[model samples]
Target: MPSYDSWPSPTWKKIIEEQLEQVEQMPRADFDIMLKKQLPMAVYNKELMTGDTLDAYLEPHAGSLGKASFFSHQVAHYNAKYTESYGTDLPKLKVPVQILWGEEDEWQPLMYAKRLVQDIPHACLHVIPKAGHFVMEDEPGQCSDYIDRFCNKHP
Candidate 1:
């Protein structure tokens, strides 16, 4: 998962600001109402923490951390090994897949959701409106309802 601060586009920042403002200005009840209006069938991740306070939490590690370099090297190493070792004969996966994507997600994009559904034999796709990469945070009720329906249908 990419850090919220790592978003490469200004539009994403604007969206984040709007979401933060929504969270800040509204009481819990009103926030719930707003979410329902935005996305009618999403699940909430109650553990999520947002707003400017999170920026303060991440501030200490913002500079010269070498974290980006480390991850790049790790990814390159895995890419080389995986290509040489498995090629096209990687083991087939049989897990049933349910992809719930936020239409407004700046990080992953909706195309990836479409690709997942296409590539997986038994995959279902649910797209939530007015939501970003953090689907639960952006449209909690919709996410939750989608998960419930997927589970019931599959089971």
Candidate 2:
């Protein structure tokens, strides 16, 4: 991840905004194609998904124009809002927090996990090897085990 101050680079933000603008007008078939193209970046272990699993992942993304637009908006404004607030907000989190990050995440790099652990007082970071942005999808068993252990320790 880029520094919070420079997150969502101007070029990337422009591209996402343009995508959001066209999403409402896109046909469902075309949107599905776009999702298909994007799937690889989301997971590190491609072998984990069968055709049926791929279809299952794409299913909920149908009729998701609103969701896409909302996500785009967040990305567009992350530097403006989230960066300014997280400095103050993160340390306020009093409860134990587990940050399960994907070591191979393309969208958010491992450096972010370090930054987050530094920012939050009660947060511990776990980096799952061979996992991308979709950690649970790339390594479901490891992700679940981490979650279970976190819960057991915290509870």
lDDT of 1 by residue, 52-133 (tens): 5333433442433423332234322322343334323312447777888888776566775775577556777888887777
Model 1 clash number: 12
lDDT string for model 2 (82-124, tens) is 6655666777789998888888877777887888899889799
Write down the lDDT of every candidate, Cα atoms only.
0.52, 0.72
Candidate 1 residue 7 Cα shift, in angstroms, is 12
Residues forming the 10-long window of minimal summed lDDT in candidate 2: 1-10
Q: Compute the lDDT for candidate 2.
A: 0.72
Regions of model 1 farther than 4 Å from truth: 1-49, 52-91
TM-score for candidate 1: 0.47
Cand. 2 TM to true fold: 0.76
Quality of model 1 by C-alpha lDDT: 0.52
